[model samples]
Target: MRSEEEVFALLIGFAKSDERIRLVSLEGSRANPAIADDEFKDYDIAFFVTDMESFLSKDDWLDFLGKRLILQKPEDMELYPPQLGNKFSYLMLFEDGIKIDLTLVPISELQSCLKRSDGLLKILLDKDNTVKEEIVATDQHYWMTKPTAQKFTDCCNEFWWVSTYVAKGLARQEFLFAQDHLNQIVRPTLLLMMSWKIGAEKGSSFSLGKNYKFIQHYLAAEEWELLLQTFQGSGYSETWEALFLCQKLFRTISKKVALAYGYDYPNYDERVTPYVQGLHTKCS
Candidate 1:
């Protein structure tokens, strides 16, 4: 595996050698000073180039990076439509186990790139001094913010409403369908409510990390255990248990958040809970 220094040297060296590759910047977790350094962190790089077509014209240029175990060109794929307009990316995992998500941006789009940036960027090379201001990287853009009354009510409503789908699927013995709704909709909505409660207590300056990965650090021991219980086994009984726990946890946290913010908590849970309970009773 290539060391971080070796990877940086190679990336910077390649950018300097190619006049077409005018500017290079590192983005994502690598650029954020708050994030701890780890081997798993991908080299999220952006290259502002003179001619994107010339680079796209051949696969040989990427050979200079490393011997890839596999590569995914999102823009070149049919199944997943490209989301980055006027930009292309190569998601490469080298044989040595280092992954690099390198994006190529047209030089003409530099201003727009800066505008769309999430404030986590460290410029490595700018040959023409195109960037006059200092690029201070911060993860503040991703930090948790206080939720509005409307947003809080909406989250509660979504949680209670979609939860019915989970009950319906389980009542029909459609395990996969129930699991999908629980995992995709119900749990995410619960997480949102949890994060709002965290924000209310901790203030809005800190982040819970992507997908609230750092959420457990903030939760109470019993609450955390309950949250874990919501991720249950394959059995229908277990799925029902998970759904009930999710409802209980969401109700507890959301009410606290509502109290803190003085927002009127919606009564959807009052109506939805009995419906779900009835379905479970009928199925049993």
Candidate 2:
């Protein structure tokens, strides 16, 4: 595995040597100072290039990076639609176990790129000195905002309502619907509630990291263990246990958040818990 220095040196050196790539920048956690340093973090690089299509036509250029174990070209695929609209990217995982999500944007699109930028962008090389503004990286845009009373109520309501979808699917023996609700809706709401609790305790000024990755830092050991259990097995029995745990955690966290902010905790939790419990019992 390449050291960070070796990786960056190879990364920057390659950009410096290539005239087609006129500028380079880093994005995501690698650009944020507050994130605890981790070896597994990917290299999220953006190269402002002269011709993105010209590079997309070739395979040999990427060979300079490292021996890639596998790589994904989202823009080149039919199954997955391109999300970057005007840009193209290669998501590469090298044999050395380092991953780099390198994006190619035309030099002409620099103006639009700056406009759509998230706050966590750090410029690495600007040979043409096109960037006149500050490129200092900050996670300010991602800090949790204190939810309004209405927003808090809505979050609680959504969690409890969508939970029925999980219970219904489990009762009907439809694993996909149950798993989807648990993963896509139920877990996200739990994370949202957890973020609110963490924000309330931590001055409402820090990030919980993407998808609540840094949440364990604020959660008690027991609470974190409960969270781990929520991601356990997926059989009907296991799914019910995880769903029940999710409800318990969300209830505690959301209730605390509502109380701290003087917002009303919904009365529906009392009714829904037993209803889901009945479904699980029926399925059992």
Candidate 3:
């Protein structure tokens, strides 16, 4: 694997040599001060260019980076529609085991990019000093936020409503359908409620990381164990057990959050619980 210094030097050197590449910035975890350095962290680089077309037209220049294990041009692919409007990105993994997510941005879109930035960006090179303000990268943009009353109610509603789909799927013995609703809808809603509770308890100043990946650090040992149990869905009985555990955890945390904020906790869970339990009994 290439050293971080070696990779960064190569990236900066390449940008300096190219006149079209006016500015370069590092984004994502590599730019965040709070995230511990790791070998798996990608070099998330953005090049604000005078002409995006010049870079988009050729792959030959990418050889300057390294030998690739695999490369994906997201905007160029047909199967996956491009989501980055006016921007193109290359996701590359080199044979040397270094990965880089390089994005090309038109100079015209720099202001718009800054507006949409998640506060995790550090400028590496800026020949023209296009960005006058100091760019200090922080994970603050992704921090947990206090939920509004309506938002809290909606989260509770979604969890209980979609949970019915899981019950329906399970009663019909459609394991995949049951698992999809459980994993995709019910659990994410539960996580959202859990995060709100965490924000209330721990202060909304810090994040639980993307997709709440860092949540385990904040969870109690037993709670984390229960949360893990919610993922077990290999069999019909296991899925039912996981669904019930999800309800237990979500209800426990969400009620605390509602009490802290003096918001009314809805009775959706009360109504949904017995309905799901009745289905479980019927299935058994």
**What are the lDDT figures for the candidates, one per model?**
0.93, 0.90, 0.92
lDDT of 1 by residue, 98-127 (tens): 999999999999999999899999999999
Task: Indicate the worst ten consecutive residues by lDDT in candidate 1.
Answer: 204-213
Residue-level lDDT tens digits of model 3 in 1-284? 88999999999999999999998999998998888898999999999999888887889899999899999999999999999999999999999889999999998888898888999999999999888999889999888888999999999999999999999999999999999999999999989888888888889888888888899988889889999999998899999999999999999989999999999999998899999999999999
Q: Rank the candidates by TM-score, best first.
A: 1, 3, 2
What does the lDDT read for residue 281 in candidate 2?
82
Give the TM-score comparing model 2 with the true structure, all chains together.
0.94
Q: Stretches of candidate 3 above 4 Å error?
A: none
TM-score of each: 0.97, 0.94, 0.97
- Pitting candidate 2 against candidate 3, the one with the higher TM-score is 3
> For model 1, which pairs clash?
none
Clashing pairs in 2: none
Which candidate number has the best lDDT?
1
